[model samples]
Target: MSGIYIHVPFCLSKCYYCAFYSMPSLKRKDEYLESLRQEMVARKDYLHGMPVSTVYFGGGTPSLLTPEELKTILNLLHDHFPVEADAELTLEANPDTLSLEYLEALNAMGFNRLSIGIQSFFDDDLRYLGRRHDSRHARQCIDWARSAGFDNLSLDLIYGLPTSTADQWNRNLDLFFATGAPHLSAYALTLEPNSILTKRIAMGKAQPVEETAAVRDYGILCQRAAKEGFVHYEISNFCRPGFRSKHNSSYWFQTPYLGLGPAAHSFDGKERRWNAETLDGIRSEYEALTPENAYNEYVMLRLRTMWGLDLKYIRREMGDAFADHCERQAAPLVAQGRLSRTREFLYLTDPQMLFADGIAAALFY
Candidate 1:
């Protein structure tokens, strides 16, 4: 089935490593919300009567919205789309922004899931990342959420910080596990171009990420999560059984989804489209995206997951000859133990996921 994603592009403060389309300024919140409402109406026909099984509010910080504003958007969604009765509605919140009352209201309004940004439980790491929340807020928010009756909670953590040692990372992981969260998404720290961290590194003001240390630390992450009974469902996601993110899984499973608001992306089964990142630059047009582009996207998304690509489905959907080309290209890597295949699917074997993008590119048409 289809899903809906709402891009709330406002943040209280810009993080050093973030490159997503977010602005710290709240000057256009009202205008942007209006535009978002209009965009939803415009794209109402995009899903073609398929029930929206999931609705996700993601962004710079979705918690930036006041409770009323958030409710208004949700109400509009329910009105416009045929939302399923048990739809998995998720809202991304910052630790410092969500109040107990606000969370109570959110639960009352039918948001069943919360994805909180609790990057690190250390003050120094918070400072390093330019995050607005402290260690205390991170700890308090989880307690607050649990008390608010939000059982389906997911948290985001980043490992491989420049100053984070193996022992320190373990402590962070220990604290994270202690929370008993059903879902977790942890990622390695990367310096992207044009981000504040990258600029500082170029100017010798900040240190570059150590590749060797990152790989070693990622190994630690895997071991700890597995010991805690969490499955490494995707490269950066861990969940206990029955707790995998249904919305995110839909994306990996190549299900149709329409994204609303600025910088959002939409994909029908065959094509894709992205809204402009800014209001002024956005043209009012929704057109069919290319099939070749869709094929590349399919490969990129599927290869990132643990399931990898299904050969039979690819052969049928992308042509048997192209499927053969993918296998031929991946043959050497499979022999090298960096990739593997069953009768139906081809996947990265542990070590290769470190260079998943490179390996996926090698096999791409």
Candidate 2:
């Protein structure tokens, strides 16, 4: 029910669409790893000794770490934290960075899950995303992972690329499903400010994202995933039965989790704390959780997932009056086909989930 997340904030190169806190230099790897060790010691009590069921090594590309370096970090976590025996330990891998040997080392170190970043099967789309791996490496990495005995595998794919046609996207999905990857985290590309893609769009060098096209592609993806027997458990995640991500499902279920390293966020069913953007600054802001902080966090995070806001949880955490106010405000949207409710839970319907943020804000207490 509880989780630990470690953000490995180093990448070989920056992707054009990436806005996450990451540095493309390995110059400070030793220093950063030492700092992370110190962070583990400093924030050991953040989860209050909850048995950590999940430990995710998310990017800037966790596979970039050498096996020895990764072992040191994992050893430190096991030494300091209450990581469960069957923890779903996940490492985000870039296709070019994973090899049979590296994956074997990872398996030996108890990393059971691999979320491989293979954004597209097409070489052109890979180039557009500024990905380091070619399409061949992407295909090869999945085979190597299976050969290394990784069953809990997920592949991250992207659609709605300016260079992608409907046929091309379908072909990409065809190849992806053919690999027998049990889980898929496919996303529609977004152009955000300060990203190279955004800058290119602003300067007329790249075509603007066709919103209609993106939505159409999303619908197509959802339909195809359903036909392939993958559950659309979360907005962007699809998985074969029993293959849903435990860590992400914990987030939606409002379970407690601690996030380590730079730009990671933590929640403990109440309060939320996020590490700083820069590595040094992350160390400095390790201990700042308050009661009022928890309430605002419950609202923001709970509203982001398919679970939405449960009045019972709000009444128990907040107050009955606040819960009533939320429901009263949500009534209009529910009637307008943007929201849906059972007697126990209130949430956005499938069509309305695309506007979840705006709907949540409209009914915010």
Candidate 3:
């Protein structure tokens, strides 16, 4: 299914580990809105007349946008794109910005999913992450969303702090499951080179994330999620039956999607493009993928999900040479007990999923 992604690039504050582009103030909201509309009009055909099944409003705290502002963008999308009648509309929210009235307005405007960032249900953890919301606000955010008639809820959590303990991570999971939210997107804290968190480490002001801590937390996440009856559909995502994020699935499934706003990315069957701000104005940069690049991506993305890599599809679409290469590459891992396979598919073993990226890289064309 085709999808549309809108990056709301305004945030009240920048988190230490965040690398996504965002303005720390909303002073340019009007300019951003206008530019976003221009982008929608210019790239309306990116999906090639496909019916859009999902629309996701992500980052710099999309919840910062007023409901009226969000409605305007959604209306424009419907006017220019063939939005499906039952499209899954999702918005990423910071718990500090949600209220009963605000959530009710969002629900009224057809936002069926709310992805709230409630990273950890501990005040100390929130402080360490530089989150503005306390555990109390997070609890209140969930209550308000439910009171406003939202049932398709997703919560974001981060584990693998440099100082993380098993008890702390377990507490976070316990609190999360108690909320009864249908979806959880849990990630190990990653400190990119340019991120503030990494910079702090370079300057000796902060400690970097520990690999041992991350591995331990990920194991806990997988085991607990399984016992909780949540499916591990993606590397960092878990959901109750029928609660997967369709918009996000479009990325791994290699479906076409149009991305709007500065720093957003768009992909068609053959090309991938993204926007950036320049001295002149926002402009696009893109590359036409080579066969090898496409093949590498196909392997990388497919293995991130529980569905694994389809050998049949590889043989049918990418030819026998590529399929043979896959077979040769997978043989060792399969024997090592890191991967298991059927005649038609190959998958990572549960204990080895955190090594998925490294494994995918090894299979690259």
Candidate 4:
């Protein structure tokens, strides 16, 4: 099954740590809508009639779009694409943009899933992260989502805040589980090079993320989520059984997907393409992956998930030399137990997955 991603590039304000392309002003929203529709029509055959199993409206703040606006986009998708009836349709939301009424409208429109950016349950953390919503609204939005009949709900939480403690991070996790959401995306607080957080730290106005504190936070997150019955399916994502994000999971397996709007990325079986990050109109750019680039990407993406990296598949798809390279490079880490090798696959062990990027790089050609 394939997927579709729509990038909404407008935001009320940028988060201190975010460097994603987003327009801070909504003055050109109508213009954006028209350009997005045109792009959709043009790319209708990009997937070549593949059954779309998931549709994600991710953004700057998709919830800011009115119910009618969302409906119009959905209508266009249904008209042009082979979107499955049971497709996992998701909208990424901000806690500040949600209300009971808004959530109810979204639910009624057949948007079956919601991913709310509730970065923290503590007001202090919210303030430090430059989030627009406070702690109360974060909890309230989840309750509203449930009350609105949303069963497939996901929440975003940021750990590794320099000002945070293990107990505080534990409390954030506790509050998240209490909400009964089926999925969670817990991310480490890495400062983007040119982001406000990075600048502040460089200017001595903010504390940097301490490695020891981050490790402790990661340990608590892994241990507690396991106890709570959440599966650490990907490096930064956890989900209960039957609730893994199908759209996101597709990217790992190299599934062809169509992405619309500015700053959106799309991938066919070989070439990956993206729209330039501009609000006026859509400008596309693409990269056709060479065999070596594709192999490196396959190694990078496959290793980040619970599925791990498979030697058999690699040997068949990328040939024996590449598979041998992978096996040889992975042997030392496997011996250290940072990675574990089963007969079929090499997996980044649970605790050692914190170094997933480094491990993947080590196996790269």
Per-model TM against the reference: 0.96, 0.93, 0.97, 0.98
Q: Per-residue lDDT tens digits of candidate 2, residues 148-242?
A: 98999999998889888888888999999999999999887998788988987788877777877677778778789889998877778889998
Per-residue lDDT of candidate 1, residues 52-74 (tens digit): 99999999889899889988998
lDDT of 3 by residue, 252-317 (tens): 999999888888888988989988842125699998988888889999998999999999999999
Q: Using alpha carbons, what is the TM-score of model 2?
A: 0.93
- How far does residue 287 in candidate 2 sit from its true spot (Å)? 9.8
Give me the runs in candidate 4 sitting further than 4 Å from their true place. none
Error of 1 at 91 (Å): 0.5
Please write out the lDDT profile of model 4 over residues 1-365, one tens digit for every residue: 68999999888998888988887778888998999889988889999999999999998899989999999999999999999999999999999889999999999999999999999999888888889999988888999999999999999999999778999999899899998999999888888889999998899988887877777888899999999999999989999999999999999999999999998999989899988888766799999998789889998998899899989999999999899999999899888888889997998757677888999999998
Write the candidate numbers in order of decreasing lDDT.
4, 3, 1, 2
lDDT for each candidate structure: 0.86, 0.84, 0.90, 0.91
Flag regions of model 1 displaced more than 4 Å: 281-292
Model 2 clash pairs?
none
Instruction: Tell how far residue 274 is off in model 4, in angstroms.
Output: 1.5
lDDT of 3: 0.90
Residue 54 lDDT in candidate 1: 95
For candidate 3, report its TM-score. Answer: 0.97
Between prediction 1 and prediction 3, the one with superior lDDT is: 3
